[model samples]
Target: MDTAKVVATFSVGIAATLTATALQVGKPSGWDELATGLLFAAFLAAIVVVVFDRLTDANHGNLIQLAFVHGWTQERLLKELQAATIAAVDANSWVLTAVRISTVAQVGISTLSGIVAVVSLLT
Candidate 1:
């Protein structure tokens, strides 16, 4: 929960801020409307996923921590990691998901901004 909240809080805040700004100042037509809709949807999804992830982590992380601390010895940790590869998987999932999502959103914004700029120029 803490980890997810740590990630989600800032992300949601940023998305809310960006979508709100886009809604206010975005171009009136052409691709702007579509861009606005997609941005707003993504913002909403970010909020939802952030909340869900935090709730999920809050419930699971504690148990995992406890298991690691008391139930698992160093040898066991090594064996478990070797067998299930959980830690590596979690790290990889977190890193990849964050990077991929951010990259996609960046590209989306750049594309929409380019569309708006071109349309603005033509108009």
Candidate 2:
């Protein structure tokens, strides 16, 4: 089994379990509530990334094949593709930055939220 896929699946399973527990327990502390929201957002972001990546992969393969058929050198094709604009941002950076930022934010906020939730529960 792919380790990364297994870990991702585990992460999602944990999130779902926590969500269900949170719903069944009475009103959660603010920290718990925030954590749940962030987890939900993180899941949504994952879905969006998967969809966008699949869409781009389709275009990426086609572009490479087209370039090959036209006798364009790999290096030149890569340079042009990297410099190309997608949604007004550099093709290479736009989606990547978005996906990275969201993932980082999700992880950071989730950690912070977890800490706060633990403290709140202890107090």
Q: List clashing residue pairs in candidate 1.
A: 1-57, 1-58
lDDT of each: 0.50, 0.54
Per-model root-mean-square deviation over C-alphas = 7.3, 6.5
Model 1 scores a TM of: 0.34
Best by lDDT: 2
**Reference-based TM-score of each model:** 0.34, 0.45
Write the residue-wise lDDT of candidate 2 on 1-123 in tens digits: 133234334454565555555545566677567667766765665454444441232246656777888988989788656644352344445666665565555454445444544544554
**Candidate 2 residue 25 C-alpha distance from true site, Å:** 8.7
Please report, as a residue range, the 10-residue window in candidate 2 with the lowest summed lDDT: 49-58
| Regions more than 4 Å wrong, model 1 | 1-27, 45-106
